[model samples]
Target chain A: MKTYLKLAAPMALAAALAPVPAAAAWRLVDQGETRKVARSTLVVTAPEEWNRATERPSSRSEVWTQDGIALSELTFYAKIKDGETLFKRRQGKRNPLPEFDKDMLPTDLVEWYEDTANIVLGGSLFEIVEVTPATLAGYPGVHLRYSYTGGDNVARLGEARVAIIDEKLYLISFEAPRLHYFDRYIAGVRAMMDNARFK
Target chain B: MKRLLASAALIGLFAQPLLAQETGDETPEEKPLPSAHGYEPQDDLEKGLWYEMDEAEKSLKESRFLIEEPALNAYVRSVLCQTVGDERCAATRLYLLRTPQFNASMAPNGVVLVYSGLLLRMRDEAQLAAVLGHEFTHFEKQHSLRIFRQIRTKTDLLSWRSVVPVRLPYPAGMATQLAVLGSVYDFNRDMEREADAGSIEELVRAGYDPRAASAIWSQLGAEMDATAEERGHRSDKNRNGGLFATHPRSTDRMGRLAYLAREAAGDGAGELYRGAEEYRAAIGPWWAQLIEDQIALKDFGGTEYLLATLAGDDPLGWTGDLLYARGELYRARAEDGDFAQAADFYRQAIATGEFPAESWRGLGLSLMRAGQKPEGQAALRSYLELRPEAPDAALLASMAGEAAS
Candidate 1:
């Protein structure tokens, strides 16, 4: 614990304490060049390693950058037989499933979507019908009235909510039953983001 | 994170199912990837380009062609060669693509490539290097090729499992060729273990902080858990489908790596080993392009992990901005967005200097929407000063100025 604190304090402080040189506020959302991906058709071919009856999550496909992994690839975990187990097959990759490559993002996004979808790795979208000034954690911020549902074709589950401050490019989002968690967790995300900063 | 680097020796243990085949002579799982730093084996060090040799090339050719782009091909190869020890390693190559699950590959050659998903989850350089070092071992010692040759030679035995047909030149002795491949694989497995032990050394030698390796795997486990809940499944093998977890897994992998990292960090203030800044400079163009593109995919765990990793690095300046962006990501989704938290990320970004002019504007907008006038007005004014000629400058000034008056 001391090692972590000793090492982490410095790094985290460096991360937390480095004076951020103010740069031009870059808007990733609403950018004309930023591809607005309306929808992505996810396709997962359940590997033989996963049990079919359990509604096992098979594979997943999404957009990613061509080289850098940050913008590409979504990993899956080993299959754990939770119930009356058939194969007792520990947890792992199947001999049949191919190894995951870093470059899969470009293929999954562009090749799969035929280069048509506007692909950004993170951030949610909302229309600013009316913008109300607000502060949550002692910092200047805003609250946007629910404008539009995120995407028409491939919205994940519920009423999508995103947090934005002009200075940053990353956003935290949640999609659930829309009724309960959205209101509750949106604040939690806000709290987490409040604690977020780069030195 | 530890098992992520499969030791060549462990391959044999895991590969007991394969090595036990009838007529098997050599263990393909035993072979290691060729040397990255040009370390000559005490006796068998005949250097040049052993990984891209005949049998290995055939295996490479047999696999599906995943990357067809000219630029990406070069980029992938460059990372494979320049990542570890002494660099210039051209034997291993990585290959996973367009698939949903996460995975990485260390080819029979010295080249290795990690999936972008793996990259996304890695919280820091240590984790990335740990995974890379594990693969680097495969190339440093000629394991992948050695193993492939071993498996290729014994067609009579391997034919039961391998679907790819072994087609050698008519005059050549197929049996002899297969034996060579199998022998290499057998030895390569040991090479893999050597690499695992070496992952810490290489990381230390390379000067990357090591504990992140374990941290990365822990995060991976978290991602899987969340995903499992979403899909309503017992388990989801690998992030995309099944790629990274090919070896035995345990919570211990992280602990073991952490213990090793402690030993690696050593006593004195370490001299800068590998030039991360130089690396960042070189990849600037790609990084710039990717950051915008990443959030669009909307994978929660991956993006979250990536942002945290970026934040984990002290010298790196974009963590706050990335967080600010994440706030927007969620807010936009309002469906999945934690708006209140998004508001907090904006604040953090501003406090950390992570936010530039845009963050102020974002804060102001969010604030105004939430009915916090004074704070929103101040932030918007800051945004205008930072970006006086912004596309919406007129509107922003009007809104801010009106509030001030």
Candidate 2:
């Protein structure tokens, strides 16, 4: 079923100016079972138990979180069509998310993430700590690590692995508070990435 | 507090010229100012307003987004002081914020926040002075106090005042405060006209080109038009419309200011300085950061217009950065044949021999997207060689291996 996720206020203003509840719905995903992610053309086994957001799914992406989205989030993207953004709601803003392109390089992807966080996530400060290439789902991909201070003045750390395969884009990303949440769950995220494979 | 008292003393010293002007003395040595120097809240109502603004100012001081560049800060302060006069300038404090919107605001308590976006758009010191003078007028005229009293009459001022300092992400608090300030104390057309006219007079008196005042608004209008065209919308509906529309349209403002400038110029001044070189030198170090902020907004149309404008001013000095920016823009736009265009620009940047290492990576990706695998692989190899420890290095190596086969 098609779902509509309405971000009632601008992302930049929502967290700091007005604390609006993220109108996302979730489902429980038990550990050790390979499950198909929403709308994506791939399936993966969870390393452990986690909560997956069922709201705001496109034909190519889904989100899971060990804690809440504000504290930590894991997102998956599969076969995102060219000219489509990873997040649906972001397509409406004055500075909307950049569209995905098959020809995008790792650097381009990094820029896309940066723009998304700054313009869509309402991050006041954003910096890319590092970017390196990696193999994703047995395909050439790039890994990006970044730090951003959001409008709420909370510092967050994020990491993403992205690849373009079969003329379509695929990505997995995780973000959490840099203080503790990032270190708390990064090993699990890495393990999940290690186990992930395209179906 | 000492600055305020000193301002009060200077008011009397300067009051004679103002009184003379009031009596219609043509070419008076000094113009009459609307508010005396060393202004303080006259009553509890004004005091309450200042209290709220003072808190907001404190938060602003602590804001992470404030650009802490000493040289840039000093340069901007010098311009503001030149326009407002050093004695009166002491009553105001300027905060250079790193926001990527073309906005500047002055709170009642002498806090002036200038966004980097405005700095990016400014062509010369005269333009910067014009904007500063306009904002200073807002403070000098006590517009915020007037608006606060009006809001107090209509709504509970205490509730509104409390909300101003809510912790919000990035610029959310600042944006909220600005939004609330705008909603409650929306400057009427007459106020804007006064500020605009006052700023022109200030520019002329400071020996700046009065014409530069009109040029800024005109350029802003043109940029908005370009943005509208790119977004397939009517010019009237452009996002920059709110601020520009709130004031007099650029055409009308430009016409009036040009007339005022002509009148001011009639006294036979040979030439007025725009201080273009001085302005560039002061802002040069921050250009890359400012440009990065603009591009991060992902407004292709606006970014392209801004880069083109800057490039037009100093093509040789800005060539490498301009070419790299253009390449990034085209790549981000990702339209048909854009990859080829991006590749071309990246190559041009690389040829400059002063390019950022990212240019090599960009060229590699652009070439690969354009279906020139061998050339693309070679370029990527060059990038890997240069920035071997880049976070995405392994990915590039993998891509190169794939291309080799």
Candidate 3:
């Protein structure tokens, strides 16, 4: 999965996915469940995103997590390889995203997305149900229709329609409401993805 | 009363071995795994986490009796300690916490402490094993002290958003650091990548679906996302805890683990070790509380994800009650005038047979919210007739009055 993070999505995906699921093997890999996105890497990777996302190119709208009443931000770096693995920089003032202290900390879809990116390349059939074939950018891709179920409710309070394009496992994914968001932004998403090349 | 007594007695009696004399690793060969960065099991950090595997054994002996209800205790311990009934894995001693939160932890000494909320959330053995697998990797890879040292140092953090400056005083005390640790206890980023990889194998070795890891991540994501939405934020930090902090992210792990789970799929004897009915039967007492707690917290996403996961095991007929619960959740939401959407949930509840009485009441509530007074009145009446002694009878009746012509 970290391999996919390298933008060598396909090859990294293959390496991450091909292994057998075994506890011993996991011991062989590494162990830390703290997962947060590194924005510096993203910013470094794509400077245009800041301007495009908030329409505030001049004022950098650094992403901040709303913790209780405060919005704290980090100088995050996503491009770190095992070269300077997490262990080397485990302690410092800069708190990692998704603090690993609590037993059940909140994780967003991005973490799952990164994890699944590796899975997608792992060679198992990630069956997409209720989806259609679509061109996202120049890369041929598929639209995924997924539903989320909640324990407290009978009606699925959530539905996600995601548009995606993949070339050798480097995925360009766009998530929006199945009813409107996906349809509305798919073209822009496609263009953005098409415009993107490996950084 | 009997169950409680038996539990107390077990806690008292079984706690003996925990107090008994035990041995430690005096020899170089017997040293515990080092948890410090660049430290190996044979190193000093390992010494910190494994001060006593023997003491862990002692604790297990003492704690065995803590869960007095033999069957429940034994079954739960079996699920957590035993490696999916696999002969290849050793049974580790797991501690039971008295906390009511949703969580579990693994001591470096192989002591696994499971939270009651975990049992409440899991619908089957596979899901339980899925979580256990993640923890098992912690022990197997000896990550206990690795993270401990990482937190002590207060290190690397990851985020998709731009890094904003957080002003901190020089050399803060352990007190503020501990609290900050709770919020931002940074573990080595490598450990996160390790867990992602380890979770894959742990699930496979345990005879559970490794993919459950990805599913769990997705479930976790939805839960947090939903809670944030409930609490009013497009990007809330309450939910992005440990796993997300470690590194890469669940997104990448999904792809990595998917590859891992696939290998064992073709193995002839590989059936995921889970049965929803059996899971419910084991922890029947805690289900309602778990559902209610998560709901009260208004974590619709996690709630929904949990229900869906249970529903996926619908072959075991466990989804009906969950479906009903979901309907009630929507009724509670009632935000941005989503009453009609809540009404649809009631219909599904009826379709699934979850909570007949409440689903009817919720249907009425949704109807009234959507301004269908006549139908809402009839629905409330039906609810009252169905469960005249319901806990919310007064409220229901008042609502009924408002809806009535």
Candidate 4:
């Protein structure tokens, strides 16, 4: 009986460490299944099983995480209207997020992300390491790669792919700690991006 | 009553020469400052306060935010020593931090934290000396202990939580720490006035320009006004936000400092020095990084004012960076036709041939916004050619392709 309890103890701890899905907020995303992302105008097919976070679904965005937001996060933005900002609205601020403009260039998109990281997110150190052009949803888009030292003093790396289609903005981004988490999930993110489609 | 009146008259007699000095019409003979040495807290409460501050100092020493550049550190220490005299300076330990806020605070234990933003704004050694002297006076006068005692008396529940640990995790924790520091240990108006008067006296005695005190305050006022104007709000007469926000408006502070400067300098202003060139040379290597930090705040009006102020001093040396910064400022503002203005600045920056590769990308975007598609596409192609491995290269190529068609 003692040996059985010892074996069960390790199993219990393992269960605790594993990602626990909030019954109402999350649904299992099976491998090779194409599913519509909440609030976004696009759909994605996961190459593997993943958890979709739906705790706070809005008309503009959605979040998916393998571990948790702290480890890694994949955020999607649908057809964000011209003059609208990404993410939830905040109050009592002079400058909110830069409003999306129909005429925004890839450079403008990069600047917007920079401002979001430095000004909105209040990073201690934010640097754009590279900027290149990419295709998203069969449309020309910008790919921005940046790093920031977050308030916690942990270094983080982020990549964003953004495009303007039919005067609306579509964005997909991944952020994770630069240690092991960023590289660990980057391949999966790229695969997911490869399978992403807009109806 | 007769004795009090006589003393008041005597004070007025002493003040007259100082007032005359403000107009550069007369000079008062320099009086030797009292030797500052062997300062120790006499009371139990004061000793306890010092002990608490010593712990904070220990934690601050280990903070990653502390700027550890030996040259910059030594330069600041030398200035503090000059201002306070070497004997008293021995008791103070200065730490420079890279935080982008215009503040310098002295702990009761003689640990002074000077923020990078303050260093960026100071145009000369005299200005920095005035600020350092003011903080030094706060330490010498035991203002923090008095404030701590008052708060302790008012709230029994004030806990150790107020002293935020330096290693606390990211953004939320940092915000809480900053908020706590902002609200805690703020000295009363009387203490601030005393520090101002005492610092000016120290500045003059240290051979720095007395007028630099008022000049710093005036610049702060102008920055505040510009910020207000840019936000489309009427400048508030009472809006005091930066270093003096807790003390008084810049106008009031400037008025008092100007009066005191005259009193302190009298006719000896010519002997004093601003040390502008020497100061610039000392801080030269760090200036560009400091300016970038300020711009990262996205406070367009304040940054614009700062660039203009620095440009006025050395336009030829500052032109390339200034033009690029102006383009960035206009791009962020994003008002109608602001893109065209931004494009023009980028063009000027590119003409200098010393601008960052990002300038080419900025020019391309601005041109596109201005409806010059072909020119914009050509510039974008140039950006791609220069930065072949840029993260956004694919997108730029696609745009260029569309433009050609």
Return the interface RMSD of the candidates, in order shown, one decimal each. 23.0, 9.4, 22.9, 15.2
Give the worst 10-residue stretch by lDDT in candidate 4 chain A. Answer: A5-14
True contacts kept of each: 0.03, 0.34, 0.00, 0.30
List, residue by residue over A18-72, the lDDT tens digit for candidate 4: 2234553766789898887756657888887877775643556677778877677
lDDT of 1 by residue, B1-405 (tens): 232122222223223223433343333645432443443333232222243234434543343223334454454454333446334454344543221224454544333534444444444445566777766665554444344445546556434333321211110111222112322122222353466667777666666665545565666666556545543554443311232333333556556666776777776425434445544543444443344444544444445555665665554655665767766555433332254666777888777864545677767766665567688789889888888876456556756776688
Instruction: Using TM-score as the measure, name the better of candidate 2 and candidate 4.
Output: 2
All candidates: TM-score: 0.44, 0.81, 0.46, 0.79
Grade the docking of candidate 2. Answer: acceptable
Expressed as tens digits, the lDDT of each residue in B197-297 for candidate 2 is 88988988888887788777777777766766787655642221233433556467679888887788676545787899999899988887887777777
Query: What TM-score does chain B get in every candidate?
Result: 0.55, 0.79, 0.62, 0.75
By TM-score, the candidates rank as 2, 4, 3, 1
Alpha-carbon runs more than 4 Å astray in model 1: A1-199, B1-104, B110-127, B146-194, B204-212, B226-243, B258-289, B313-319, B360-405
lDDT of 4 by residue, B1-405 (tens): 553332222222111111111122111344221124566665687686566556556655655566899999999899999998999898888888776666777776677778787898898999999999998887777666555454445343323222222211112213222322222234556677888998998898899998888877677767767766766665433433234444565567779999999888989788789988988888878876787777766677877888888776566755676788788788777879988999999899999988767678778878888898899888888898899887667767777778587
Candidate with the greatest DockQ versus the true structure: 2
Order the candidates by DockQ, highest first. Answer: 2, 4, 1, 3
All models: lDDT?
0.39, 0.68, 0.42, 0.67
lDDT of 3 by residue, B1-405 (tens): 553332222222211111212123233545533322343345575564455444334534443112355676677777754543443234355544322234555555555656555666665776777777666666656554444443334333221111321211111111111112112222344554666566666656666665556665555556556545544655332223333322334566667666666765556525566566778787776565456544443345556656766566464544546766777666544455557877876777677655556778778767876778789778888988988876445545655765354
Query: Which is the winner by TM-score between candidate 3 and candidate 4?
Result: 4
Better of 2 and 3 by TM-score: 2
Candidate 1 TM-score to native: 0.44
Q: Which of the two candidates, 2 or 3, achieves a greater lDDT against the reference?
A: 2
Q: Per-residue lDDT tens digits of candidate 1, residues A91-183?
A: 222111112222221112111111112221011122223333433223343333232121111122211112222321121122322344345
